[model samples]
Target chain A: MSSDILNQLKDVVLEFDIENAEAVAKKAVEAGVSPLKAAAALTGAIREVGDKFGKGEFFLPDLVCAAEVLKKALPVINSAIEKNGEKANKSLGKVIIGTVYGDVHSIGKGMVATLLYVAGFEVIDLGINVKGEDFLNAIKENNPDILAMSALLTTTAAEQKNVVEGLKKEGIRDNVKVIVGGSPINQEFADSIGADGYGATAPEGVKIAKKLLGIS
Target chain B: MQKGFKRKFEPIKILSSSQIEQIHSASLQVLEEVGFRYDSDKALKLLQSNGCAVDYETKIAKIPPDLIEESIIKTPSSFMVRSRDPEKSIRLGGNTLYFMNSAGARYCDVDTGIVTMPTLEQNNEGVIVSDALDTVNVFPSYTPYFEIKGVPPVMSCPVSCAQRMRFSTKPSRGAQPTDTFIWETQMAQAVDAQLMGCVEGAAPLSLAEDACNAAFYYLDAGFPIYIASGSIMGGSHPITVAGASVSHNAELLAIVVLLQCIRPGCGIIANNFVSAMNMATGDLNFGTVAVALHQMAYNQIWHSLYKIPINNTGSAFSNSKKIDYQTAAEKLPLAMCSALSGANLIVLHGGVTGELAYNPILAVIDDDVASTIGRIVEGFDINDATLDIDTIKEVGSTGTFLSTKQTRTLWKTEDYMPRVFDKTSYQEWLAGGQKTVIEKAKERMIDILANHKPRPLADEQDREINKILSEATKYYKKKGLI
Candidate 1:
């Protein structure tokens, strides 16, 4: 790719250039770049930002800015991809997520939701301490994909099972994939309670979701 | 080196302003409106027949002193709580002391406070830190369920004990009174009766009176009972130091009274902290106020009255990294207070975040520090050997005391001998990778877990211990608590 196209593509991911994505797309076209190559360039930029943030070279503020830049850049990139109709990461399906009952903590569930959004999946965040029936109601209403449950406190971790059991009670156990995460929980606990998958943190949850989704 | 006696007795510490009131209120409430739940139908019937208001729906019963007096009278005074290991028996009464770790630290800091991750590494580090402290007799904190659940959940409590228990035998090592696999230690304790408390159905002081009563019931069973009263500064009691302290002491005292009543002079542990929550939010400080307010004052008062031992959230409860300034700032005072106040058992040496967590080498560092702290409290005799005035007077005119016999005799003992500290020069330190104390501590942990062979259990003893735990676990399984 030409320098101008590369710069625009880099800005798309680093600066969350979704708003500028159309201009970046035009630049890519001007440089005779295929949508596939331009998309690869965007993914590569995100990876670099993630690496820098992980290494402390970039911090949370940097991450927010970068994500915003990507947000701004996505439409232009998406239009180009749409025009070309190149097959990239489509939806890894949809995920309905929330913290279990009697728990107001949101960080654990929030992280998982953010990661899901970033990893090219649709996420519906249901807020905190959702009752057992609520999860089932959402799943039935949305008819999306996976059901992700989170609980940071030990007292609340038990509620994850209640949600899963609620699904069973509602006669929709096998209809959706199930996953659990939190501070006090472990994989064995998830298994014992019959959860389909477990993750220690949000990023890990995304990875687990991918595995659960059979997303290669 | 001569193993001399180190006396740590805190006598001046009395209840803080809030502590006095919280207990008074809690007691009045207990006696009046908010009665207790009695699981046993027989116990319930006894209470109901004796003018107690029984709520069958809630399984709660409130009784008068007249009805409780008989049951209270039947409870023994001066029961021994035995350690699973025959060698770990301890007598609980009068000036006797036992220590335990500070527990359930808050997750996030309010202002400049930083939140932390609860990991296995942090938990083990806490045990190591406690063993490293000088005055601490016991180290109890995090649920090392990770290691215990897999490796030897059977030895979960035991391994936690072993983390710091193997240190100098001068102080008896005590473990948490967990329901899981702890009966092994209790059975083994039949020999000496040294182990301590169990969860009183959720709250710290929940079963203090009953536990002490039960242990005393089995007094003839050959175990000393230490009635330990625990209070969560912000959660269970109050957020302020004064309020938390009062609640903690009052509850501990009530339980202590029961122990004393059961066995005239029984062991009592008063556990408290000045844990304050940023009320606008729910954030709480676990350590800063713990040492400054609660432990310091507690050890002083308890020592003066009954030679009582004190349990506290020590340096391990700090909200900082490793043995940095924060750890020293939070821990040193608590240790000194224990030493000076004569607290028989000062727990949570290298512990962190109010003993809800730990750092491994910190354990060794704490142990090394307590040696110095122990010495500070011990003071010294102006004897001929210690004074060395003649030698000093002669050498004063010249130079070094290196050649002197007095120096040769005492120098080694004078310093705080570190189990995992590097005292080498900068150049040598560089040669050794210029590691801080934490690095050395981590190394020690790996060595201990890998090289050390924990003392094993005997056949009959182990069998009986397992039987007890299995029986208890069965009850829990039935209740779905496990």
Candidate 2:
């Protein structure tokens, strides 16, 4: 019976049935399935969706929808795991993301955040027009493994360098890997600003993030 | 005037006759029931006199359907805009198609991708480049950059008009933002040229006072008016294309009624610049399928149904920052769709980064795109001699037609040779350093800048333009805007 519920949970995520993801997760918990097992099913389902996206069988909206379903199911599983006095499921890493200061552009940053979450990274989005001080504060509070910055305007792209300098001044630059992206950003700008990497697009950013942490 | 491309075939129709009538009726209902706000007292008085139900306090003019149809009929089907050089004047209706230079706020570097405020010299170069391109027939208002170095905001329009007049003989459009049209009128008169007066509308069925005043001024000057009301889908307009089309059509028709009432038989080109909102980012999504459908539907209703000239500004820019595959992928489809469906003038060339910047190199590359679209719409001839059955039989079986006189005489007219796009073999491309289209565009831009010289203004006309610009500078300085 537990296997059945777990399989149902996986099916909901794979089907991108975001409406029923929470209910299925609850049923798995009530069926006495381990929260770890439920979480594993969701993660496996999302991985398959990601693989389908890679193979061009699924599109961007499908990937985003599947990730949204995983997002809905994971909280119930994680809370249950907490009640059982167990650690939550493993993540690739935690990433702090936002559009840099003076730039309110959000699609590229939002896409990066969604893709990172689908790649199994726990993401804390700071939203748009984020200042260097705010990024620094989020870094200190979250202690995330990565800091990703996005700026769409050439006028505002300088703020990415400011955030990097703020990290260096706080003496925590080594604590997290930094990846910068946006329309105005390129590899040369990333190198000049001492960034760990630059993504020409959102999918490439995911690959660079994984490589920076030496993850497969 | 240059003979623009003619669509030998019927325009592509996206809406059934009943659907077109449905949209038209809905638009009339919105105009009659919801009523469009005309902020100017003169406009209100004029509408009230023309049998439109007007509320002076609310500034809403509820136009009746008969009056709307009558006003649309009063507008001329086509009109000529005179340029300093007679050869550059362009007709703005019928089956003919023309290209206009797009506008941007800043200038982008071709190699480094850095954007900055354009200098006056760079702005002049942009105009000259547009003037030299074969496909660009008209200069849109604020043709290269909106802001140039050392020019205050209020004076930018007049200065840009002066630069366009001095550098290029093409017919230019006029803009109104704080009495600049007054000076633009004087400058155009100084050169014996005509300006396509721009009277734009604010979205959600409203016309601001400045735009209304510009209409009065341009009408008094006897220049044709270009009307546009650019809106965002799901924000300022309805989310669905069908719903948005009703609102967009209603907004434009309101202006048409006002212009026709102000001056009957005036030339007008209704522009459809509506764009979709990127729901995720809250920015304008240009060159999307939604925008293309909107333009196509707008073209059908205005061109085939109302018999009015139309312009499409949806192809002007892209969300992509650089001249990459994304830029082309975004721009070309909407442009082609506009050409196939009935557009008299298309706003294309140089616009990039969602109207944030313009690059002359990008304009050089877009020249190729514009020419290709022009050639496609100007469909091939289908006559007996051109069919060349005799030549085909003469070169029967294993023989080639490469040496035929028909092939030699007709290949140039039959095919479009792009100015910047590469169509070389792999070995030839490698031998030539495999330069991409952007590199080829850079070389072309340099060549034009070095070789191309636009018709110079006569000494008296140059002095007259200088005198008018000085008067504008002094007028704005007294207003503390300079």
lDDT of 1 by residue, A33-94 (tens): 76667766776687687777557565443454455455555556667677776765566789
Predicted candidate 2 versus true structure: per-residue lDDT over B1-482, tens digit per residue: 98889888889999999999999999999999999999999999999999999999999999999999999899988999998899999899999999999988999876666789999999999998988898888988787999999988888899899999988989999997788889998899889989999999999999998899999999899999999998999999999999999999999999999999999999999999999999999999999999999999999999998889999999999988878888899999999999999999999999998888999888899899999999999999989868989889986863335434465457778889797899754434665899999999989988999999998999999999889989998998999987
Clashing pairs counted in every model? 70, 0
**Cα-based lDDT for every prediction:** 0.55, 0.90
* lDDT (10s digit) by residue, model 1, range B162-194: 333333222232333433324424543533334
Candidate 2 — which pairs collide?
none
Model 1, total clashes = 70
Instruction: Give candidate 2's iRMS in Å, 1 decimal.
Output: 21.9
What's the lDDT for residue B149 in model 1?
A: 24
Given candidate 1, what's the lDDT at residue B321?
Answer: 38
Let me know the DockQ for model 2: 0.01
Give the poorly placed runs of model 1, Cα more than 4 Å off.
A1-216, B1-5, B8-136, B139-147, B151-186, B189-194, B199-222, B233-235, B238-242, B260-265, B314-316, B321-324, B354-356, B449-451, B463-482
RMSD of each: 26.5, 24.4
Error of 2 at A17 (Å): 74
